[model samples]
Target: MDNFLIITCVHHFQKDGKFYGYGPFIREMNLWIKNRKKVTVLAPLIYSGIPGKIDLEYEHPHLNFKSVPAYHIQSWIARFKALFQVPYILLMIFWEMSKASHIHIRTPGNMGLLAMFVQILFPFKFKTIKYAGNWDPKSEQPHTYKIQRRLANSPFFTRNAKVLVYGNWADNSSNVVPFFTASYSETEIEPVRKSSLKEKIKLVFVGSIYSGKNPEVGIYLSKILKDKGIDFEFIYCGDGVMRPQMEELSIQLDLSENVKFLGNVTSAEIKSILKESHFLIFISKTEGWPKAVAEAMFWGCIPFTSPVSCVPEMVGNGERGVLLSTNPEEIYLALLPYIDDEELFQKTSKQAMDWSRKFTLEKFQKEIVNLECE
Candidate 1:
């Protein structure tokens, strides 16, 4: 049987016995595995209550899942133990990697590090690394993350590998290829019923309310719109460590009437909410490919996001979306012009939707086939 070893640090196969996270990544793999009679997943698993996995159903005849302890370290002792656990984990993955004709890895994680080291032992192996994170060299990151990127891109370190990254970054090795996640399709496209430009606009922010995502920016922008006498409401979906702080900021800005936090939601529910929103406010400082932003664009919601990682590329270099400035005041002033422009809004929404439609599951699977082929 043709075998493939898929490795990652993220909790892919959860204890709930369902795969989640990196939805597009896993979905593409599931499709590609059809070519191989046998496929094995080597990754962490966590217990959860999430109903359905992203791609695979519960019973896939050709799939084999081997989960390791979630790469978790709290104290110095735990951290030391984790360090020792790396070799054993690598041994487990190497066994599968040796048997497989193709090897796929998700990098910048504990498991990724182990795989990276093991990959060095088999320089002739055919492998691919899907790096689902901000690839900007200048962006601040953990030491291990920086090391992983360097090693994975280094000519001497990484050979016979294709390193897939979210956005196009400078000075990348020949192996680095830019990629994107898809949402809807040409057939799925429908006429969006937009609200009147004269009426209150509905806005949305769907992601963690953390420093990286900068949920505060959404609140600040909403307050600016309110002060400008613009009738608008911003809804935030997704809970995070910074939820309490963000809620406090909303109240402090007297934006309680204009902003609502709906917390985390399911994909179906999120899609329904997007249909009702006019724009998606994502001021994230960094991203590989923000799925929420792409999803928003798919539903005809214009995105207002900071030009981080591949965001500019994803949004068609601001043709279909708004780019944020480092200065908060500048961002507020820049967007004020679009507050009442109906034609601009419609054109931008259509452009966003059209751009997102180009990257579909069918297209993604085709690319993977090419990558796996000689």
Candidate 2:
């Protein structure tokens, strides 16, 4: 039987009022657990008051789980605790890595660093590091994230591994590979229809409204359209730290009536909105690969985004959607023509869906099979 071990700092399942990381990682991890016979999960387990369950059920009888003490350095006590807990975490990972034929790591976390150092001891070890954040070095990142990337890409440190990253960056070691996320099937193709040139355009932005995402960009652009006597409306979904700021910005810009911000919505609700929208405004400061862009494109919302991380590649370098620069006026001017052209809108929507469908669950499963090969 093939033995497999996964190491991550993110909670696999939650017990308290807190949720774990987003659903994409949870769903992807479950794919391996359900398909493999001998699999052991090594991660922190939190005991809390929230409802928590695996996004996908495990059918394999041979699956096992081992919980480790959660390690972090958020506060003074937490830092001291992390210093003491790290050794035990290393021991747990070392033991599991030695026994398992496959080592899978989920990164940009404390456990990821320990796993990286442990993996170095076994130079010929078969492992995969899922770097699930912005891959570009030019973008601002935490010092820990930079260190992890350096270690993961160091030819002298990490060997015989495939480091799955969201976007392709320059000067990468042989280990880095560009990856994508998908939610639909090739067979379930539904052709997206664009509105007539004379019709009012609908623009949608989905995701947390943090300042980093710059949801105000959507609001500001809509205001610009309104000022130009263009017919358009903006809808926003998801809540975050900057919700209050967005409210103030909308009121200050006098876009309270034209722009609507709906918070903490479900996927079905988001899908309903995406189906009717003609374009997606997603101008995040940084990302690994913003799932919302792909999700919006799947439903035929032409994703207009800042060329951050792998967004240029994802949007086909403006073939699928418009790439924003540092200037908001430039972004508004660039998107005006697409809003006025029905044929360009429809063609781009179809191409975006076609490109996005290639990275579906079935394709992801195939890659996993190849990676776990005995």
Candidate 3:
């Protein structure tokens, strides 16, 4: 029996005698442990609060969960408190590492950082590291993220492990594998019927309403489009700390009629929105794979996104989708041509869907199985 141990920083919750966590993360994990007889998860557990719309329950026959106290070092006080918890966290990881036959580490996180070091002590054990963050050598990131990236790329420390990262990087070791994530399966691919530009343009933003995701940029873009006398409707499909402020901004800008905020809807609802929408406005400052972009493209929604991470490659340097700029006017100018030209919009939409369909959940599962066998 394959004993699989997963170490992650994603917070899990227990409800009605079931384990739940962030929807997308949980979905991917379900695939990873599909064939394993025994599965152990080491993560933080939240004692209270109901699962959000995007939280999902884990579907495993035999699962063992080990809870670790969550800690962050973002502030001086936080750093001081985390100091005392280090020994306990390290000991927990080491004990789990000693028994597991196969270990999987989700990286660019506090728990993953510790597990990365612990796995080094068991070099002969088969392991896989999923670096679920920006792996670009030049991108600015937190100190701990950089450290995790360095360790993952070092063959000396990460032996007998496949380090799966979002994009292909030039400065990586032999074990570092370029990987892509998928939200939809081949069975979910359907013919998208999007409305023409002559009708009210339908734009959607499907991510966190936080600073890093740049949800405010979507509002600013809506203002630019409104000023240009372009009849449009902008929808936000996720929630965060900035939702209230963004809601107020919409009313203040007289965009309350044109903008709608649908806080944290189910995956099915998001797919339905993508099918009808003409464009996906996602100007996030950073991402690993940006599942939202891929999901949008899967539904024939052309994305207007920033040139961050592997997005340039995903968009084919403006062939499949528009690469955004910080300036709203510049973004407006770039977007106008696509809106005006039906041929260009249709062609680009097709290209985007074709590229995204190649990375479906079916293909992702096969890759995971192959990694385990290797």
Candidate 4:
């Protein structure tokens, strides 16, 4: 309980002559290390030749960082490199884990999967694995992902450990705990007003503009609206490999005027956009409890998303917003009615805001504190 050791697959980088990592991941960890005496982070710290748009440095001072060589199962070459490197990584984890009584592993990732196996060597150490991805017990996924879930969910395998997951799945292990992540603190909460349907519809799509999250779905939504001569704007708030491709597709669809891509912005900037936006079009192919969806709902921005993972429960089974289909035509038809009905729009926005506010960072941090202390 004195020292908190964090392990994850999130790559750390150096920019502006300072160490940096993903903003939201660092922010959540910042909340976690509040009461701890010493905090340590062990993960792959890559040296990117060029600068990144979303890299954020850790906020705490005088903290320890152990940079392990980053590896993945993406390509055959990478897999071969990892085969020789994994043993060294495991040795490093074993040594680092021995130094702390409290170990936190960020799961559904390659590094986390490795940590899950090594933690068995230290059953006496209390560990918490935060499964940041989809946790549907029956959901189809890769072998590695399934193995990590199996190891963590078995009391016999992973002793003295607890898993923090998005949803409450039936027939779970004793250590599996239902939990949530938050972006804003209780003090950051403000009076949220419903967006007016009379104005030009503004849709915000947050998350990496990758094929998996399907930024194309948002663009297609804009295309459908534009074809009907409807006045609306779709703004993408994150950057990824598919960003350029999505941008080109937007122009090709003749949606140049309606679609806007704001590469990557800070948490503050996104919240400002969410406050004024009418809907968050996050029709991703996969997600856990996406912080973007919850943040949008927190500011009275209705969500228009696919029922991936626990999104249906998060969006109140389409009561708070629109649940979409794979077909762009069907998605358009489902949303067009809400666009025209001002009263219905106002009602759902309120319900969404109320639900999201209940899961603030203050509450989230308290849960982490309890788990860490115990």
Candidate 5:
């Protein structure tokens, strides 16, 4: 019986004697711990009256949860509070590390940073570090993020650990392994036949409607299409604090009829929408793997996304989908070639489906099992 310890920054909620967390994160964790006899999680805990629509419960028989305060250094007050809290958090992590057979650290987060250091004390213990962030050496990131990356890739510090990164990076130790995330499974693969682009083209966005995700760019693209006398429908799938502002912007742009906000829908609904949509417009400022892009591709929804992190590799450098620019005019010009070209659109869609199908949930789970054996 293996005892697995996972330390992450993902917030877990407690309600009615049950634990819930963000859907995608929880789903991936479920796969990691499915075969283990006992699972222990060290993360921030929140007592909420009700879980969000996109939250899911952990599926395990034997579970141990250690709650830690979530902290940030965005403000002076926060920094001061974190300074006092770090010692307690580190102690908890070290205590947990001593008891576990295997340690898993999810990185590019405050909690992950502490865990990375704590794991070094047990140099011979089996460990895995999932660096769920941009692994591109050339990309600019926060100082702490860079520190975490360096520590994870350093053999002397991260001994007996496999550092799982999103993209294939050069000049890394043998422990640094390139990995991918998946949404659908082999059994879920179905023949997706999308209708040809017509006067009414369907464009969808699946993610938080916030500044970081740049949801406004989708609206601007819709405005451009409308101004060109093209009939279109833009759908926003996820919700955030920016929804109200984006809704107002859509109204101001006279896109009330063309834009629809389906805030926080189920995964099934998003998959269904993706199957019918013509394209996924995601012009985010940054991303790790961008599950939305991969999910969109899985359903043959060609994603017009910014070339961030591993996105260019995922899209095959515009062969599977268009690499987007935040500028609406530039995005329009990039997309103009594919709009009316049915043969090109079909070819790209096929390419996307073919590439994305290679990374199914089945494959992801098998990879996890292989990692555990190693």
Candidate 6:
């Protein structure tokens, strides 16, 4: 391919001539651009903001970033605005995708939904889509999300597109490819050893603190453990709208000594914390692939998560971690076994670590190279 163009939903901002957005998205896109001569990105450029702790940018020198209007489907007013804004964005997407040798779309977002529809006009173009949300065919989601999935899954409609999704489903379209995102380099892999039968267990929550991620559930679980006289420390490593609520509830539940909100931390700090912690909690309502769960597993931390989407597959159907019910009593029982048996704990940890380490950034890059060859 002569030119590689990526149209994504992730909002990127420019600062000091550098583009910044989500770190993991940028990392994966970096791999996608490795062998291309020219690269262009058509995304929202939020110009008035500084980079966050996890925000990063594309480092490609010959990069062209085309700015487009961002749209939201939240309120009536936003929807009214989107009626005018969405078409503009779609036209921009069509303009950019038309000039590319390859088209890559990142979902599930408003931009991705637009891209899915826009891409249909160019049926013969080479395209790849990373559907980075819940890929469960049975999961409940918004209408936009369902429409995006339907458009991408229809083999005839979304032709010449490799939809890289999180899990292996029973009857997916031929275009649907199972894919994984990476965090650490192969050289960064070290021997990690953790056991739950310690004097004090360290539990980590590594996602956003909001309703979608259900970060409050982690605090509630910790409170339940505390009330039962269990000795554990809850560490929240992300920030969101629910941080204030989590803080207030922790205080009300008398979990001051047990729960600690670390806010958004650096990748290195997160890695260090995971390496030391015995368990990682990710009881979310939905997910595509919980990258944090896999990252924690790579450091010998067992995943204590809901069986949503591909989580059961990622955690080996509760073989390498704890698959929990929404009920507090059931979750408590599921975790109780881990705190007593050292051998079982070590086995599970090792199983998780060995499985997760197989999908490093090096491997991810090679896979991209192979995809290019195809």
Q: Compared with the true structure, what per-residue lDDT tens digits does model 5 show for residues 228-311?
A: 998789999999989999999999999999999999988899999999998999998888999999999999999999988899
Q: Tell me, what's the RMSD of every candidate?
A: 2.8, 3.3, 1.1, 1.7, 1.2, 1.4
* lDDT tens digits, residue span 1-374, model 3: 57899999999999988899999999999999998899999999999767888999888989999998898888999899899887899999999888899999999899988888888899999999999898899999998899999999999988999999987789989989899898888998878878888888999999999888888888888898898899999999999999999999999999998999999999999999999998998988889999999999998899999888889889999888988776777777877888889898999999999999999899999999888676
Residue-wise C-alpha lDDT for candidate 6, range 1-374, written one tens digit per residue: 57898887778888889888888788888888876789999888898888899887887888988988788867999999998998888788889888898999988988888899999999989899889988888899988999999999999889998999999887689889899889989999888756446688888999889898778777778878998888889899999999999999999999989999999888889999999999888888998888889899999998989889888988888787888866766767777777878788888999999999999999999988777577
Q: For model 6, what is the error of residue 24's alpha carbon versus the real structure, in angstroms, after optimal superposition? A: 1.3
Cα displacement (Å) at residue 125, model 3: 0.7
Q: Write the number of the candidate with greater lDDT, choosing between 4 and 6.
A: 6
lDDT of 4 by residue, 346-372 (tens): 888889999999998889888987885
Whole-model lDDT per candidate = 0.78, 0.78, 0.90, 0.85, 0.91, 0.87
Per lDDT, the best of the predicted structures is 5
> TM-score of each candidate?
0.89, 0.86, 0.98, 0.95, 0.97, 0.96
Rank ordering of all candidates by lDDT, starting from the highest: 5, 3, 6, 4, 2, 1
Query: Clash pairs of candidate 3?
Result: none
TM-score ranking from best to worst?
Answer: 3, 5, 6, 4, 1, 2
Clash counts per candidate, in order, are: 2, 6, 0, 0, 0, 0
The whole-model C-alpha lDDT of candidate 4 against the native structure comes to: 0.85
For model 5 the local lDDT of residue 162 reads 90
Candidate 1 vs candidate 4: the lDDT winner is: 4
Which regions of candidate 4 are displaced past 4 Å? 15-18, 49-53
In model 1, the number of clashes is 2
